[model samples]
Structure formats: structure tokens, C-alpha cells
Target: MNAAEIARDVSARRVSAAEVTAATLARVQAVDGDVGAYLTLLGEIARSSAARVDERIAAGEHLALAGVPIALKDNMCLEGARTTCASKILEHWIAPYTATAVARLLEAGAIPIGKANCDEFAMGSSCENSALGVTRNPYDLARVPGGSSGGSAAAVAAGEAAIGLGSDTGGSIREPAAFCNLVGFKPTYGRVSRYGLIAFASSLDQIGPLARSVEDAALAYDIMAGYDPMDATSLDRPVERTADSLRADLAGLRVGIVREFDTKALGERSDALYREAYRDLERLGAELVDVSLPTADYGLATYYLIAPAECSSNLARFDGVRYGLRVEGADVRAMYDNTRAAGFGPEVKRRILIGTHALSSGYYDAYYVRAQKARTLIARDFERAFAQCDLIACPAASCPAFVFAAKSDPYSMYLMDYYTIPMSLAGLPALSVPCGWTVPEGGNLPLPIGLQLCAPLFGEKLLLGAAAAYERATNHALAHPAQIGTVPA
Candidate 1:
């Protein structure tokens, strides 16, 4: 069941919250071995949380999530639970407080099943960069579940949890959602609080959910979106209730097809599939119009610079003087160097080096400041595009979930977020919803393709309504893996 169904069943007293959580945990035990979706399982805490929900329901209290099981990306704090961010340096760091988003979900009676695996400090395009373990696509064990939210997507796709809370910097959430055939929603920047979430790129990081259905993603988004005094970056504006406002049709709304993001460039199959998806949307009452983001091609270069510079600054706090892994050295300076060298992965080190160079004495203005200017122009591009359209539609990823070790270099890997980075740079709300299936060459099982729908800042209601309309017209998310997901059929 999706989050809404589980919540309905549990709240109606037809099934207990404890039963739902237990079944979810059991599924994890049976299936996670092959998928490696979880970095840490919270069985005791999950059961306790579910029992509290049951008691509240018995007391006649209404909960939005009401016993729905969730998988938390390891980067989000859960207070006392290990929040590793899939990195070795902080592999055993127990969070001192819960992330506001996680707290909100729990307040709504959502039970956390485990801490999902991710790329080291949410850095990689694929889960391969995780130092501890690898996460496989539930559809094909030999393939990858997209990252840095790979584990979260894997958990949801494998039925171990109803919703997977993931943090998106570039395309962490959406790319993985595309790979795993789930709906991953990245709310507008500041729509959700950043407090208690370990920073990656402070400017671009946004928390959202990966779910099997659009309604479920909207439900989670509504419960988690709001102002937070704890997070200075949190948006103080009134939050719209998107789940309740989801429309059955996209009447009177214009959906933009990015001129720069043409589907034909992705190949004939992708072109045909996405054209069909757009047609499905048009049939559901949306007006399709052409829109262009001239700076879309520059998003990748701008993102790498800005995100890495921010990462370099944020990660400076992880010196040996603080909590987590400590590799002893002859002196204080040596200790810092020793600890970081031992803890951080290859991808993390590469980004840090690039970021440090970008911020260095002779080059700060040359790279860092220039990237900031480019980001402003990118934002302007989106602003102008929104004037012509309500929501933008494009491919979620360049391709379907590829086999493990497919990308040979970092450049090849970085290209995975080609379609997702611009929105992240602009801080707009975007989501990837399953649109169709594709059979890879020599592969029998079909992999999913996603149609990335983006909206102007705080346009959650309009964006979700259109996506929900498209989703209802095409129930692509309902499709399951033929005969895989860590267990025998």
C-alpha cells in the first residue's frame, strides 16, 4: 500500500499501526539484503513510534500520516539514531536532535523504518560512492538505484516503506526516483526547514519524499512544509495544503515543454515515450506550450562550482576536534588531515579539492563569484519561463537505471543530473513521476522512465494538481518490478 492507503486503513481501525510497522520491518529483513537500502534499521524505535500512534488514534486524535512507514535518508537527523550520510568519517555519529521534517512526519504519526543509504555526503550520482555498502535497483540487482538518495528510493520501490524522505541538492531525489520508478518530490527551497539536516550545499539542499504515488508524495509534502524558527532559511510564508488541493484535471493550467530539453535528444524511444506522456497530460486538460531556458546548459557547470564551494565550507566543521571518527596524528593540523583523509571517500575528496581551489586566494572571484552570477541568470531564466507557463515538463534523467559500474568517470556520472540541476540552482519546486517503462538492450525486465515536472517557487498546489492529473490518467507508478526486490517471487 502507498502512504495514503496505509494511513486510511490504520486510522479507520481496520488495521493497527503496530501491524503495519511490523509488516514493513519484516519486509526489510527479507528484502534489504539484496537491495541494501538501509544503513541503519530502527526496529525498536519504529515499534515504539507505531504504538504511540495507535494510542493517539484510540484517543480519537487524527494524524495525517497515521502509521505510514517511512525511510529516512541517512543525512536527515533522527535524534540519537546514527546519521551517517553514508560517509565513513561520521559513520557512527548519533544525531543530537531530529530534523524538523522528520519531526513533522513523526508528529503526523509516520513511523521510520530505517536510515536509508546514500552517496558519501550526498555527493555521487550513483550509490556506488557510498563507503559502507552498495544499493541495487530493485528491478535488477545488477543495476543501480540512483543516488545520493538511492537507498531511500530503493526502500520505497522494494515495499520496505511507504515514503522515503530524501534530500536533493542537484538531483539526488529525482534521479533516484526515476531509476526506482517512484515519485520523488523536491519542494521549493525553504518550503521545508534545513535545521537538523547535515549540510551538503546549504543553498541547494531541500528535503522531500520518494513515494509510489503522487498523492502520497503530496501528503508527505503537506505535513512537512511550514515555517520553522529553528531554520533561518525556512520560508515564513503560509504553506499550501497540496494533498487536499490535488485536482483530477489540469484545466486552465499551462504546462511548459522546455525547448532546450527536447526528448528527441535523449533517443527515439525516450522521445516517443515522453511525447506520449505530454499527450496524456494534454488529454487531461493541460495546455502544452513551448518555453525556453537559455541558461539551462550552463546549469551543470554552475552547480558543480557553487555546490562544491558550499560543501568545502560546511564540511570544515568535521575536523578531528569534534565528534565522530578521529584518526590520531602527531599534531592538531596533522590530526585534521589524517581524519579527513581516512574518513572521506574518493568522490568527496575530489569535490573538496575542486571547491578549495575555487575558493582559493587567486581564484575566488574567477570561479566562485562568477558561478554565483551565473546562478542569478539561471534564476532569471526560470522567472522568464514561468511568465510563459505554469509548470515545466521534461525528462527526469538522461536515461533509465543503468547497470552497476556503467559510468566510467566523474564527468559521465555528473551528466546524470543534466535535466535536474537548473531547478535546484533556481530553487524551484520539482518532482519526477513515473511516466512509462523501457526495456534496456539485452534486458528482459522493463525499467521506468520519469517525466520531471517543475513549478515556480511556492507553486506546489498548481504543480501537484497537474502531476496528480497526469498520474491518474496514466497509472505508471502502479507498475512493479517483474520478479525482483531482494526476495524470491
Candidate 2:
């Protein structure tokens, strides 16, 4: 069931929260071995939380998420649970407090089933970078689920949870959602609080949701968004309920087609799917307008420089002195060096080195400073595009889920975000929803393709409404992986 259905059924007393929670946990236990979506399972806490929801329902108090089971990316802290960000550096570290977003979910009666696995410190395109384990795609176990929020997307796609929280820096949430056949949302930069979420590129990272349906994603986003005094970057504006704004008709809505993106660059199947999605939108009464984001061509380059630079600064806190892994050495300098070398994975190390070099004295102006200017240009491009349309639509990724080990080089893997990083650079709200499925040349099973809709800053309601309308018309969100039925009853 989706979050809305679960909440209604639980509140109506047709099914108890405890029963739902147990069924969710049982589903995880039965299939997680093959899926590897979680870093930590909070079975006891989930049951206890569900019981509280049932008690509230009995007391005639309505809860938005009532008994819906959810999964959080490991980077978000939940007091008393290990928040590793899927890195060995903080493998044994337990969070002292819950993230504001997570706290809000719990208050709304959503049960957190576990901390979902992710790329180490949310750094990789594939979950293989996780020190904990690789999260396989439910559609094809031999293929990747996409990353750093791959686990969160996989859990929702596999029906292990009703909804899942994911952090998007440069397509972390959307790429995974595209790969796993789920809806992923990335709100405007300051729309959601970052407090208690372990930083990974402070400027670029935004917490969002991955769910099987648009309404579920909207529900999760509504509960998690709003100002938090604890997070200085949090927006002070009044929270808008995206779920309530969902509309079935798209009349008068002008959707922009990005002229900057080359359809020839996308796989044949993916390109075909996106074109069909465009036609579908036109049929639904959305006017299609051509738009261009010239600076978007430099998005990947800009994101790499800016994100890594921020990551280098944020991750500095994990040094041997304060907490996390501490390796003994002859002196303090050696200790710091050794500890980091041992704790960080290969991908993390590469990014740190690249970031440090880019921020170094002589190279700062050449790389880091230039990237900031490019970022401003990217933002401007979006501003101009938004003037032409209510939302901009494009393929979520250049291709669907790739088999594990398909791209061994880091640069090749980075290309996975080719269609997604521009919006992140602009700090715009974007949603990725399944548009269709594509059967690869040699692949026996069809993998999902996603259509990404980007809106102006703080325009999540408009973005979600269009997606919800598309979902209602196509019912693509209802498609599940073949493995979904394999979970034990």
C-alpha cells in the first residue's frame, strides 16, 4: 500500500500500525539479503513507534503518516542508531540526536524501518562505493540500483517500505529513483532543513523522498519540509502542502523541453521513452515550449568542483581528534593521515584529493572560483527558462540501470548524472517519475526510464501536481520489480 492508503487503513482501524510494521520488517528480512538496501534495521524501534501511532489513533488523534513504514538514507541521524553514511570511517558511530526531517516524520507517525545503505558519505553514482554493501537493483540483481541513495530507492521499489528519504547533492536521489523505478524529489536548497543530516557538499545537498507513487513522495516531502531554527539555511517561508496541491488536469501549464539536451546522446530506448512522455504531456493539456540552458553544458564540471570542495570542508570534522575512527601513529599529523587513509574508501579518497587540489592556494582561482561563476550562470539559465514555462522536462538519466561493473572508471560513472546535475547547481526543485520501461538489447527484463520535471525555486507544488497528473494518466508508478513478489508473506 502507498503511504496514504496505509495511513487511512490504520486510522480507520482496519489494520493496526503494529501489524503493518511487522509485515514491513518481515518483507525486509525475506528479501534484503538479495537487495542489500539497509545498513541498519530498527525492528524494535519500528514496532514501538507503530504502537505509539496506534495509541494516537485510538485516542482520536489523526496522524498524517499513521502506520506507513519508511527508510532513511544512512546519512540522516536518528538518535541511538548507527548513521554511517555507509562508510567504515564512522562504522561504529551512533547518532546522538535525530535529524529535524526524521523527527518530523516520526512526529507524523511514520515508522522508520532502518537506515538505508548509500555510497560512502553519499559520494558515488553507484551504491558499490558503500563500505557496508552494494545495493542491487530489484529489476535485475546483476545491475546497479543507482546511488548514493540507491538503497532508499531500492527499498521503496521493492516494497520493503512505503517511502524512503534520500539526500540529493548531484542526482543522488533522482538517478537512483530512475534506476529503481520510483518517484524521487529534490526540493529547493533551503526548503528543507539540513540539520542532523551529515553534510556532503553543504551547498548542493538537499534531503528529499523516494517513493513508489507521486502522492506518497509528496506526503513525505510535506512532513519533512519547513523552517528549523537549528538549520540556518532552512527557509523561513510558510510550508506548502504538496499532497493537497495535486491536480489531475494540466490545462494552461506550459512544460519546457530543454533544447540543450541532445536526444542522440541518450540510449535509443531511453530517447524514445522521453519523446513519448512529451507527447503524453501534450495530450494531457500541457503546452510544450522549447527552452535552452546554455550554461547547463558546464553543469557536470561545475558540480564536481563545487561539491567536492564543500565535501572536503564538511568531512574535515571526521578527523581523528574529535570522533570516528582514530588510528595511532608516531605523531598527530601521521595519525590524521593514517586514520583517513584507512577509513575512507577509494572513491572518497579520490574526491578528497581532487577537492583539496581545487581549493589549494594557486589552483583556487583557476578551478574553485571559476566553478562558482559557472554555477551563477547555471542558475541564471534556469531563471530564464522558468520565465518561458511552468516546468522543464527531460530524461532523468541518459540510460536506464546498468549492470554492475559496467563502468569501472570514475569519470565514466560520473557521466550518469549528465541529465540531473544542472538543477542541483541551480538549487531548483526537481522530481523524477517513471515514464516508461525499456528492454535493453540483451536484457531479458525491462528496466524503468524516468522523466524529470524541474521547477523554479520553491515550486514543489507545481512540480508535484504535474507529476501526479502524469502518474494518474499513465499508472507507470504502479509497475513493480519482479522481485517484489518474492518477499515472504
Best by lDDT: 1
- Residue 284 accuracy (lDDT) in model 2: 94
Query: What TM-score would you give candidate 2 relative to the actual structure?
Result: 0.98
**CA RMSD for every model?**
1.5, 1.2
The backbone clash count of each candidate, in order, is 0, 0
- Per-residue C-alpha lDDT of model 1 across residues 1-489, encoded as one tens digit per residue: 889988998899999999999899988888888889999999999999999999999999999999999999999999989999899999989999999999999999999999999999999888999998999998888899999999999999898899999999999999999999889999999999989899989999999999988899999999999999999999999998999878899888889999998788888888899999999888888899999899999999999999999999999998977879999999999999999999999999999999999999999999999999999999999999999899999999999999888896999999999999999999999999999988888787888999999999999988887888888889986666534543221
Superposed by TM-score, candidate 2 places the C-alpha of residue 258 at a distance from the truth, in angstroms, of: 0.7
Q: Tell me the TM-score of each prediction against the true structure.
A: 0.98, 0.98
Worst 10 residues of 2 by lDDT: 480-489
Measured with C-alpha atoms, the lDDT of residue 330 in candidate 1 is 97
**Off by more than 4 A, model 1:** 480-482, 485-489
